[model samples]
Target: MFSTYLFFFLSTVALISAVMVLLSKKPIHGVLYLTLTFFTLAGHYILLNAQFLAVVHIIVYAGAIMVLFLFTVMLLNLNIEGEFQKSTLMKFVAAIAGGMLFLVLIGTLKSFDVATVGNPELTQIGLVKNLGKTLYSEYLMPFELSSILFLSAMVGAVMLGKTTKK
Candidate 1:
């Protein structure tokens, strides 16, 4: 009962923050709203008993990514006078697109089996131990491949960062 209420509260905050991220005129405000949205998503992960995911979400999105976004926004030097105003036609088109997306989401929700109950035995699925076991066992190949991909990306970044002689 309490969980349900908490979930709804968190969800409401997330939705509001997400909307604020888009609606905010100032870039810094938008970044702050986006950070709030990320925090609320972390709250949702906590409510789902996925502590690992919650921690990672906060660390990656709210912490590192939000900092990067803030830096980018600040470096862009977006002045109020230099801001671009949206035309009436663009606003109307955006509203129509938003409505269509809402309708699609509602249709998807209706197709889901809301009455289905989760398996109580699988409660530990979100824990670090189980996650490690699954990754090392069931998803070993994909995990290793992703690690290799990251290594290659790091190498490429280092190569690009190096200053070559003229």
Candidate 2:
């Protein structure tokens, strides 16, 4: 009963923050809303017994990524006066596209079979030790590849920054 209420509360906050992120006039406010959304998602992860995921989400997204977004917004000095308003036609098209995507997502989720999704006795799958073992044994290559991809992205960002220095 308590968990149900908690879930609803967190989900509502998450949804509201996500909408605020999009609707916020200032870039910093949008970033703050995005951070709130991430925190709520981490709360969901905690409720789902994914402690590792919740911690990582808080650390990586709410901590590091949000700081990066805040810094970027500050550096760019984006303000209402410097920004151009979107045309009504463009806004209408974007709304239509967003609605279509939301409908597609709902349809796909409705077709999904939750019963056959995972092993019935795999409750310990979210534990850090089990996750580490699985990552090292079965998903090692993909994990290493992701690290390499991040490294390349960092290098690209540095190169871009260097070019802009002049």
Candidate 3:
């Protein structure tokens, strides 16, 4: 009962914040809404009994990614007034496309037979260790490569901001 109530509350907050993220004119406000969305999603992960995933979700999305977005917004000093789009046609088209997407997703899910859930055998090991083993063994190379890519992007952003005129 408590979990159900918490899930409903968190989900509503997450959805509202996500919508606000798209609607907020200030880039910083949008980034903050995005961080709220991430934190709520991490709460949902905890409700699902995936504590390790909850921590990682918070660390990755809220702590790292949203902070990066906030930094970029501040670095550019993005103004709400300068970023307004005056295209009603584009807005209408986006609304239609989003509605179609939601309909298609609901239809697809209603037609599917969900897989049966089974009890997981943890083998008496901590979840963090298990997750780390899986990540490092099965997905190490791609993970490291992505980290390098992010590092390169950081360097590029810094260089572009600094190296302008001769």
Worst 10 residues of 2 by lDDT: 113-122
What TM-score, computed on C-alpha atoms, does each candidate reach?
Answer: 0.83, 0.85, 0.80
RMSD, candidate 1, Å: 2.9
lDDT digits (tens) for residues 83-164 of candidate 1: 7878979988998999999999999999986875785325887887888899899999998999999899889978986999
Residues 1-166, model 2: lDDT tens digits: 7878989999999999998887888878888999999999998887877777889999999889999888888888874542776998998999999999999999999998667665423467777888889989999999999999999999998888885535
Steric clash count of candidate 2? 0
**Ranking by TM-score, best first?**
2, 1, 3
Q: Which of candidates 1 and 3 is the stronger one according to TM-score?
A: 1
Candidate topping lDDT: 2
